[model samples]
Target: MRKREIVLRWHTIGLVRTGSTNYLIHLEAGNAFLEAANLSLSQKSKHDAATHYVNASLVFKKDDPKKSIQCLTKAIEIYTGKHISATSTLWIGPFLSITYTTLYTTKFSRVIFLVLHLEMGRFTIAAKHHMTIAEICEKDLVDIEQAIRHYEQAADYYKGEESSSSAMKCQLAVAQLASQLGQCDKAANLFEEAGKASMENNLLKYGAKGHLFKAAICHFCVDLINGQKALKTYEECYPMFADSRECALMKKLSEALEQENVEAFTTAVQEYDNITRLEPWITSLLLKLKKTISEEEDIT
Candidate 1:
């Protein structure tokens, strides 16, 4: 009877879809579940309590974030402690199973916690989330460093879920930010990674032109040898993209870069712009690369 009662309580706490309930009713249901789950403070019960608390917090997230934080903190405490062991975790089958809900619960809770911090104007909090968190980290807070971290986190998470396109976009964001930080090699690698992810997802734009083009440009920013090698490698990887206009532009730019001729590079860029405006980001990187080449010539 006690075990049956515990299972029922666990069901109540675990599957409470707060979005479907009235706010007050959800709160009441949550409190009741918390009470039942806490009746016995075994590891299973503590885990239930943590889950219950997270659901409870989700109810009051908009109006009472501080309360939500307190509840989430309790949840975090249970999950991070050494008590939830592997063997014992197996015994607590229903509680610690690797369901979609189970796997994402901790990650989602952290995202919510960080989102709450962003809402409260706490810009210094760890940047982490699905999508909104990355936007807030980069667009609102302007913390490029943290934004990059969160974007990478998001990419990894999406990759785990087999969300290839979504993962590609996150990788693209990380690559752009890495370029901005002047970590051009890192940016090039990330861009190549994004391109590969896109191709794996059958994303035509990125697979054929977008990411490979950007990767080559990132290499260009570093030096002519690396840049030409990157372009050659990109063409070899995507033979279909070898004849694309963007690739032609890259070839022309490479010649100009090799010659350290600013006029030729500028003319090539303007020629491309006259037909189809280069992405503003690409234009900016090109200008930066031009300046680097010019500076190297002056130094020599």
Candidate 2:
């Protein structure tokens, strides 16, 4: 081994052993690892460098999270081939967990490593992997937009695998985020797709009612014409929904919005809520639909 590589390794080991007590030492050790990574003769050395960077990050985590994330990003870029910014609210925990756990265990780690580096032809595994990462972004980090992108990727892979149920599962998650983001048209289309898919499955047919109901509401947010058209289509596809309370509420709200009658819209929602409690997400979207009528009335 070269004199520089040997020196860098010794420096890294010494600094890391003493770095825990001194933040500056920790930072210096990180810098040394980065330098070693650049001069390293093998992938193993580079991997060790990345691991050391992660250790340095933990030391900076409490006092300066941004610096910690920058270190983590540097470590990630070594493996992921791109630098992730600290400004983005994405939790890097998933990436770090995969790195640490896989490297330490060396079990299924090789499979994932092959998948990442080689881009192996394992669509189902890749799809499921991305889905897990997407869930972490959504549920833990609350980064809905990032989660949507991952879910879309997972859905595409699932489709390629001819896994209808799994694809719809991902699509449904994206639809929920779209509704929250006020992308009414996208949400409506995705929900409609989910409803159709669910109706085709005996075990999931009951969920079709909920999906169709959300679809109509999303279409309503777009406009009354689209809402009415969607309602008719949903009713034709699933006759059970036509007789349901949710469908009746949608019809009542449609009439109320068409006439710009705020009282009628409020009454319809109140009556529905009294019978079956609406989830907060549903209630929020309903308010947005109501806003359209209120705005139109103001204009007229």
Candidate 3:
């Protein structure tokens, strides 16, 4: 009876091992089927094409333009019915157009046509086509001012669409460009408008930068005007700097105005003393002040 019990125990162990192996095999097959199903779905949705193009774009951004172009081409072909999504060609169309434009040479007909139109002074037409190109290229380009202008034109063209943000960005770009051109008044106005728009949009940084630019305009205007009002403007707009020459000059001017001492004021004038020296009108005023001070000293 003991021998029979030992044999039964061995048989039970063998049966348990077989069951464990079968269970593992079933799990492995299930995982394989799941992977195959995922691949089928990816192919059906043309998601693989999107993935390839997006990865290639990333590679291009990382400085491997040639490899990136190759990857993009493969992706374009994959999406264009070579391997996936044969019945539909939606996702790859815009991406291919963008890639083709990026890779276009001067010899390319479209680029040549664009150049000819631009050279012929067809600015409006050229701008329209350039906008198309920019839309395709999207974040692949920089030139903030150019992008802003393109978006502005696009917003105008698509008037029915909501483009308040685009308009505000365009205004900001215009303000920045005007500031660079030293058109302080126009820049200040645009900045103010941008600040208002940004505040409405809950864009804190944009509003702050706008206020900063407005302050800068005030500072520049004050320097040009040179009076008590200008002095007050400078004080109001004083930015954090290690040492600001403009602030120093303003302080010196204010001190000289307060002291009523001709020699001290003249000596305090640094490099900008020429401004006071060359101006006959300012020199006459200074002489009058000096004479008045001298008379006061004499009476004392």
Candidate 4:
């Protein structure tokens, strides 16, 4: 059993290194790992069986995210049964909503490692693995709120890494997604961090303007005074972008806000849509913002 297991693991790793681009190789790797898992089960080695399941799930992630999620759900479900805790359970929100490919396409290998450590009752190792899984899921999960939670967890984990700029991109991803979801306050804060991160890393100098712009827009969504201040700061940072269409779009919204013209704001959004279609989430957020602004106007 040991020899067979070693061979299967080597086959899986070798294939991943040399032939990951080939779908047939992934299929072969998956089959070999599945066989190894079955062998472990037959031998009544729960630990080894779980390991094989984790490996197989990683092998299948690229070609079959749906199956990967199933394997993850199985591993998580098993781990939950073994050790129940308030802290562990608190972080399992995204995992709880795991459906068979109807929801996410994240890498599940870290999640598998988390499960392995959890089963062994190693809280420290499990916590690190948990953060890694959260990062991966934050990049791929469809649910905005869940993704935000993952991003927050990931920033904490990633802050310790040598390259803080790379961590900033993770923050940027969360901020952009949050803005699209109308979580304006959180988005503004994240975008500010992204801007500062970029400024600190000369490599991201050109990208700072973009981050600040997004942050300013998120601030704009929350309140007019803060919005104008943020927009002015962004203007000071990237003066050349003053005449750009994106800048104009923000300006148009500001003008509408000053006039309290709901119809003009809606029309401006529609006009922007004519030039470039907004994402569904962005559309939803814009409509919500418009509704809120209109309601405020009705009060006085």
Q: Return the TM-score for each candidate structure.
A: 0.60, 0.61, 0.28, 0.56
Separately for all candidates shown, the number of backbone clashes (residues 3 or more apart, or on different chains) is 0, 0, 0, 0
For model 2 the local lDDT of residue 127 reads 73
Best by TM-score: 2
Q: List ranges where model 2 is wrong by over 4 Å.
A: 1-121
Report lDDT (CA) for all predictions.
Answer: 0.66, 0.73, 0.42, 0.62
Worst 10 residues of 4 by lDDT: 86-95
Give per-residue CA lDDT, model 2, range 94-211, as digits (tens). Answer: 2333343444455676655654543233456557656765776677567889889979988998898788889998999999898898898999999998888788888998888899
Taking every candidate in turn, the Cα RMSD to the unseen true structure, in Å, is: 10.9, 9.8, 22.0, 12.1
Off-target runs (Cα >4 Å) in candidate 1 are 1-130, 200-207, 297-300
- lDDT for each residue of candidate 4 in 221-243, tens digit (9 for 90 to 100): 88888888877766666654454
On the 0 to 100 scale, the lDDT of residue 274 in model 1 is 99
Where model 3 places Cα greater than 4 Å from the true spot, the runs are 1-57, 64-160, 163-170, 181-186, 198-300
Local accuracy of candidate 1 as per-residue lDDT tens digits, 1-300 = 786477466547535645454666666655654555465355356555655666655654544444554555565455444343323322133443333334335566765454334333211111122344456557656778877876886676566555666777788888898898888999999887766656665545546477888898998888889999989987887765687888899999999988888899999999988998787777889999889778978999
Which runs in model 4 stand beyond 4 Å of their true positions?
1-54, 59-143, 180-182, 199-203, 240-243, 271-279, 297-300
Writing each residue's lDDT as its tens digit, candidate 3 over 1-300 gives 453344334333433333333545433333332233234334453433334343333324334333333444444334333322223233322123223334343367775565434323322332333344343334444344554455455445333234466545545555554444455566556665554445455555334443433434333433334344544553554342103544454456456545655566565543545543434433343344345546656787
